[model samples]
Target: MKSIVAGLATEHAENGIGPVVLMLHGWGDSLHSFDALVQKLPGFRIVRLDMPGFGNTELPKDTWTVEQYAKFVAEFCKKTGVQPEYVIGHSFGGRVIIKAVSQRFLEPKKIVFIASAGVADRQNVHNMAFTAGAKIGKALLKPFPKSLYLRLRKELYRVTGGDYISAGALQETFLAVIKEDLSSDAAHIDRPALLVWGEDDIVTPVEEGKKIHRLIKGSELKVLSGAGHFVHQQKADEVAKLIQEFFI
Candidate 1:
């Protein structure tokens, strides 16, 4: 289904016929990222959307922070009349959920975060260094041909594990989102929460999950073996089973 939320054209999907389970995908992913996981989750109303700047959803004209994304989710739910009983977020989507629920944007009975990002620790420091290096590299390459400069810049981002090259027009927004840590937000969560992490998740990593788990008192953390960043997709059955058990 398509709807206009926060003045942005949004693409979303609704399936099944039970309690609403809103699933938020990670950065660089669409609602389709949960295709396998959704299928495994039966007997629940599943809601997933192409968040602003991703999938078919129109990107915001101005750069947006995680708080803005949380507000957009609240507005989208209001516009769609969706009162999620259980909310699930993966990666970047998890960051939005944490900000939203902590701020009372959307109140779900229980929340689940899968390989969520938002904690700014040692990894963030490395990212800051990478950003600095990129800026210096850009200045040094200004005299080279535009094509060569662009190619080298892309390689630099790849080598440094930066997502800026893939952010496309939302590069500024990406910078804003990653720089803000959500540890305080997680600390404020009083609702029941479940965190799922991939044992081999180098993106957000297992340590980040452990940090969030500690922030949200009583929150349970489950680390799946042999899974990486896209644990929900890679281990759909295991993830779905965990969600089912947690929501129950």
Candidate 2:
């Protein structure tokens, strides 16, 4: 069910009972993405929420960066009266959790990252070349119908491996978030952390997980073979077991 937290309609599930473990999902994903893992984690209080814009929650009041997202989550927690004992995040959500913990917004004892995207992404020359090519194509096709222009733009993004979503405030927010580098923040997180990554993941890459492991003191890194970006979903049981052991 949806709960009104800090004036935003947040869809969440608070199941089981014990220590609180807040779950934050990745970009373009909702709280339901953690269902499989949550089912296996009945020993702890599972607090999973659909972050703003991705699920039933309303979009941010403005074009927000990673810090803004972390602040929103902090506000939500305060309004909901939750002080999490543990925190888990994936991809974009991981970025938020890192910012929150490093800035002392939330003091969870333990943390977990699944194919996280906190490290600033490396620049791709191929994408840059494609972007240049697309700009030229756009200039040439300026007189075309609006629908035709959009279709051509989508095709360009698909062919060039460019990350383009429909133009809006959320897309702008995504652009702002990706440009942020959280290496310094990772270095400041002194809590025990579990970094889990899919060896086959190309989105965040396993290398990023290694970087996070090296930055966070006493953090553990686990690579799951044959898993992709959604490692937690692909191997829900194993991921749950790992988290249970780590927190317990």
Candidate 3:
């Protein structure tokens, strides 16, 4: 464990030797998310950290945008005294990495995005209607008492029936991060990239990975059958092998 910032210590694991490899896990996940992959990558020095708000790391004092997370990652690299030769990020971690490379905080020779989540998917008809109705409901309830307004909001969530993340600060942070898409960053990244996605993933989806591949020059997309959002965890050995070959 090390203090990447004052009052915040990151829980991390470092092992092996050779070129430096930095691994960032998904939202609601921690450094241990890459345990199996870490064991398989014996030739490189692997550093996997529990990103802020997950695992042993403390949550951010307030909501943070993706760019803030990217800068925090840069600070982490500086504090650890290791510039990554290869960087691997899964889901929300991928958003941070995308921004990092685009902003030139830490230039890695290669990057691996596993079931990344940064693209803003097109809203389906149902979602579009739901959003419209929710807006109308909010305006209609403006004259109601505060308690009544809150009740109607909860009912609106029930009617919309979407899976919202955790409440309060974490949820607010999630909202802040997801609002920004990384298509521009993907287009700007000059480094070789490997995109791994689960064929069956609903969260982030295979389409999003394809979109990222299309934007990144010389990027390769590998779709694993029967895998989900946590594809790296589900197919750790295969993912690790791909990472090794991509870096080579």
Candidate 4:
């Protein structure tokens, strides 16, 4: 389904017929990324959307921070008349959930974070080093031809595993989003929370999940064996079962 929410054209999907469970996908991913997991979660009314700047949804005119994304989620729910009893977020989506719930944007009874990313302190150190290196490289190549300079900059980002190169138009927004550390926000979440992480996840890592688990009082953490990031997709059956059990 498509609707105008907060003045942006939004694309979303809804399936099943039970308690509403809104699923938020990660950066660089659309609502379709949750396809496999959604199929297995037949007991609940599953709603997933292509957030602003991703999938078929229209991107915001200005770069957005995580707070903007959280606000958008609240607007989306109001526009769609969806009152999610449970919310599930994967990766970057988890970051938004933390902010939204902490700020009372959406009062879901429970939350599920799957391999989420918001622990920016550890990630910031590496990002800072990369930023310094990029600045130096750009200065050294300043006198070079424009095309060559741009190509080299892209290469530098690729070599350093920077998501910025892949961000395309959302590059500024990506930078703004990652700089925020959500530990304080996570601490404010008083809702019952379930954190499911991939044992071998390197993107967000299990350690980040552990930190969030500690921050959110009464939250439970479950690490799946032989799974990496995207554990919900990689181990759909297992993840679906867990969600069903948790929501019971």
Put down candidate 4 lDDT per residue, 28-143, tens digits, no spaces. Answer: 99998889998898878999999999999999889899999999999999999999999999999999999999999999999999999997567678766666666788798889
Error of 3 at 160 (Å): 5.4
Q: What is the total number of backbone clashes in candidate 3?
A: 0
What's the lDDT of the predicted structure labeled candidate 3? 0.83
Runs of candidate 3 exceeding 4 Å displacement: 123-163
By how many angstroms RMSD does model 1 differ from the true structure?
A: 1.5
TM-score of each: 0.94, 0.89, 0.87, 0.95
lDDT tens digits by residue: candidate 3, 84-144:
9999999989989999999999799999999887764543444455556666877998898
Ranking by TM-score: 4, 1, 2, 3
| Candidate 1: tens digits of C-alpha lDDT, residues 17-132 | 99999999999999999999999999999999999999999999899999999999999999999999999999999999999999999999999999999984864697677767
User: Which of the numbered candidates is closest to the native, going by highest lDDT?
Assistant: 1
**Whole-model Cα lDDT of every candidate shown, in order:** 0.92, 0.84, 0.83, 0.91
Residue-by-residue lDDT tens digits, candidate 2, 64-181:
8899889888988887789999999999899999999999998999999998887744633433455566668779778889999888767766775444454344866766676678
